[model samples]
Target: MDHDWMYKASYTSEIYAAGVQSFLSAAEANRVKKRSRSICCPCSVCQTFQYFEDITEIEAHLFENGFMPRYDCWSRHGESLAAFSTSSTANDTTYNDDASSLNSTYNNDSSNLDENDNHLNGPDDNLNEMLHDMETNMGDAEIENLQHLFEDAEKPLYTGSRLNKLDAVLNLSNLKSKNKWSDKSFTKLLVFLHDRMLLEDNELPISTYRAKKLMCPMGLEVERIHACPNNCILYRKRYENEHKCVVCGASRYKQKKDSDEVDDDEGPKQPGNNIDVYLSPLIDDLKTLWDLGVNLYDAYGKEHFQLHATIFCTINDFPAYDNLSGYTTKGKKACPVCENETSATRDVFSTIIFDIMVHLISHIVQEIKACGPVFLRYMYPFERYMSVLEGYVRNRHRPEGGIIEGYTSEEVIEFWQGYVKGLDSVGIPKTRHSGRLDGHARVGFKTFSPSHEDLHDAHFVVLKHMTCLAPYANEHMQMLRLTHPGKDDM
Candidate 1:
């Protein structure tokens, strides 16, 4: 292949265009031969760190940003090592300053190049950075285990297979989650694959337990903190060794395990006014984040920095807001912002009746000044998320478990979708709202044409309500009234 076009001054040149077309054609052929939809994009922006499924996108990126420096080998795009070596030896004069600088950075060590290349070929740049960070903090045994994981990630699922063991396991895990397969069934499927389909030396895990174990290191740890049964407090920090709740004096655990009877006199499950006790852990984390921050590696920048984060604001309903902010949402002096200036009054029954919602309106201006806008700190988004969680509850009896299972399945499915190209989503497709905005059906099964009268009515309603067109409509109406003094105002 002619390589001079890659060094052209203008991407719009005919030679550059032809070269890009040829490169894409070869990449597409290689992709088909490997039974994969995506290829590693070697554009300067991607730097061979990202995979692109669409050839057009790849082409555009290459044209816009040009190829990454010193990427003449094209090993990542299925060019043979022998061919690359032969080309490099024959075209010694083609090697430029960029290649020299890259070589000098690695001290001209072949091992260094191999190590760096291997690191680059890892699952993702961010994932590689995380692994690199982990390697620094981990013990020898943990490092060995991580290395084994890397090997598994790099190893092909089977001989001549395009997919790696890690990808295969992830795909299977996602399938299991989406279909809600039992552990036994998942294990059976794994076994069937191992016994009947895969070769004897295949690296696939034979059980759900093994699969989970394989992927466990990559997952975030979930802390299980014991809380007061009455929702008074969590038994952590100062109360770690305490046997009972500090406020309610309720026992941490039930004395009898065999009894499944419910107490009719038990309080509501919500922490209510004692929500602050449950928020201790979160508060402590925030304090730490504010004061110390955390060390993190920026994969894109290829640098390390400390990341500090703090909660901008809280969003909740009026009653829950009271619990979080330690303000009384009902009765006299209910307004946290107004303080003593509240307008509460006693009713005929000697009851302090005050519209807490109306009182909250006084605080909105101040809140907006501090947090930009009410929408930014409003409960609508949280309410929508709660609705989503509610939908995830399949079993009313075990709603929490159902939500967790559903959420985990969704996460798996989402992660799997990132890897597989052209795979249809598992759930209901999102409605496109084809004709809602444009006033014409661009895409859909059915189409209708509005009658002249209906169109006129719709247009009139739109023109009358639109704030931007209100002035123009009013001006036109004024002109009409002036022109025809006999006409009555509509």
Candidate 2:
């Protein structure tokens, strides 16, 4: 919670500028000033000597790209400084006294700290001092204060202690895909590990409920609802207060307990047979994403197209002409545009001309005639997204809630991993020569093109090697011919 040492140990702009300015010889410095030209900066940041007007400009540029005295301190304390300011700024003033006082003691008691392997001078010595100050500044800071720093642009920032443990717990959830662990088993393992961590640290392990309350970053909770065992009806909507199924007349709950566990007989005496989860929170979050413009991907990457905002028409095999009056599919009175319609049910289908499909198809034909086939719309891509959602229901007690958890957990992992977003895991072939291309070489050896009338067995031998016509090949061909005696090719 307190990061006073971060500021103290960090190199000032002047120090880094001085370090770079002093790196040059007096003669070189004098030449640089006389020429009034840019020189290569010797600092770690801009080593290429990017253009600067004079020595003063070069010095200012070098100072802007300041050198860090301790890489470990900059890496560790940068996040702590940002976190200390943002997360708990109000109560931070109280910890300043303790931090300052402990820092003073550390300045005096340097030798005493050496007994614990904490040297006052090393690569990590600055970090050690800062950590000590943070500890003394807020006695419970190590356990209670969680770092919530803004993400770094170039590289991911990692924090120590409780944040790392929480990250590990989160990462363990991702092992579900490969190991296929049951929800109860996974949660039990996590809680067991959490308890072990507490015990090993000489801290009193708290209950699972308390640990979750303290450690869960998102603080998401499951919503539980009681429902019928048969899933015939949810105990919601008009049946919200119902005690029994309206259609089945089944009892909504089991018999009451006989002991003091039964608090009263005022309500239903038993628990419902099923627990249904309502994931309105997840739905609300998806909606929030939509409102925030994050759902722009839903437009199927055609957002730049002018027609994207409009739903022109739905594409389907709708027999629109068959619905016309006096049209009989087999009597030549069928649809002029469709050549495959038959006599069956043409008149019956005509009665449904007022249906939504016919109206949409009419508009689609008009759009196609005016523009081209590109204007047509279909539900195929949207159905693919439905399949993705369906695949998320594994290893869960509740399929509906399980999907939400799996999807959100994957998103979190992907965020931390900094993966290129948006469903990049589809149709990755085993090899470049896999799929239809694998048989291309064999297909090139075919002696002749196969006909629809040719039997599968005859085509198989032709596909293997078309050029050879030896005794063995002839005998194999003869055997195939004898197996299919009635074939036209035979």
Candidate 3:
């Protein structure tokens, strides 16, 4: 948790002293009237600070230990504090000189205090300074816009029985996947049906825009670039504002149909023929999933934490050491997995974005497996998550946005249903086969309804090939029991 290394080496001691001084000041200002010699320190140095005889001892403890985690102490940020050299101070300078310098810069209303002596500043002055900094950095319009955005984000998506109807329509894959009508008309129709099902209907039916807006949380919105129509090159970076393709000398944007009859008042509009969606957001989310797994483990123990690094490693097909370390194959081998041989071939025309992060996940699998199988992560269990994204069911135009909108809308509806009508309203029934059977016999056991009976055959056939489990037979079990007498059943 000691993050002093993250900042510049010169600023480390300054940040530490500033934090301690601020915390001591705040502690003194907020002290109780009752007689108590000791006060708790909550700085990063001591998250749950030990009792101190007075402010002097507390300040000394903080200077040595450095600040606590930012969450524990407001003084941890010290965004406006100017750096001062306190490295030369003796162990017993009390850090008073450096502390006073920090107080003069960060603490307002210092006119009341003597110049030579160090005095504790109130938390109110620090809060005002922070407020002034925030106002100076952010404009009125920006603050208002942020406030409105957060308000909209907090608003409920749907209410009542309409929520249930929306859920029903969302789960219908046939309707979601196939397009019999325009998205606008389709959304209107779904909303109309939902309205009819509700006891208290909406005065106006849910519009396509609202329905689409509702989906934003579920889907990831990717930043798309207009690429060359002939698949020559992407109009990004150096080519971002270019009007023509560098590779083929073709127009980068789609020309207006009425180009000859141009309006004098308005400028010509340039639209790209082909758009390439950026994958950074999706990659970032995947990386966040790794963070989430670790957090889950820390919060609720291993039973609630599950991440398969192996399958993710295998499917991703990246180097193990490259991600774990900062090693790369630039001007050397193609991959770290392949040794850096002198005669390694290089592809000059390669367009794929190959970086340590693109294959960083493989290292997780390798590292986990090195410890033992119990900690080895697999990617197979996450395959269903791919289908979950596909299930959003939106049009090709801004596909990522549509997917996000559709998924979030469905999630909001499901959440409302669970809240109003109990969790079972949105929960699927668990499927389990009845009766005891040997492993081979269990493979044939049908769990599907009459409508899906044919699917059961196909499912079982696929499962047998996909899985590595050995088949069992009654005769084999009996023979094994006889051969190894009094052996426990597997």
What is the number of backbone collisions in each predicted candidate, taken in the order shown? Answer: 0, 1, 17
Q: Which candidate should be chosen as best, given lDDT against the real structure?
A: 1
Residue 224's lDDT in candidate 2: 54
What value does the lDDT take at residue 253 in candidate 1?
Answer: 80
In Å, residue 311's CA in model 1 sits off its true spot by: 2.6
Q: For each candidate, C-alpha RMSD in Å? A: 12.2, 17.1, 19.0
Model 3, span 1-490: residue lDDT tens: 1233213223346554554555555454433211223345544454432544355655655555544432321322221111111222322323333557544533442333234331122121222222222323343334433332222222222332222222333333224333323466777676766577544533223665544443322233345767665666677767789999888888987667755775564432222222112343445557766565332222212123455332144332233234334455344454555445422323322336544344434456666657555223444445556676655545554456666655555554454332222323322433464335434456556664655877798887877676353354456687899999989778
* Cα error of candidate 3 at position 421, Å: 8.2
Question: For each candidate, what is the lDDT?
Answer: 0.65, 0.41, 0.43
Q: Give the poorly placed runs of model 1, Cα more than 4 Å off.
A: 1-142, 182-185, 257-268, 326-384, 387-465, 479-487
For residues 272-360, what per-residue lDDT tens digits would candidate 2 score against the true structure? 22211233334455566545533222122212221123324544333323332323433433434443533333544575443334434
- Model 1 gets an lDDT of 0.65
Ten residues in a row with the worst lDDT in model 2? 149-158
Best of the candidates, TM-score: 1
Error of 2 at 225 (Å): 12
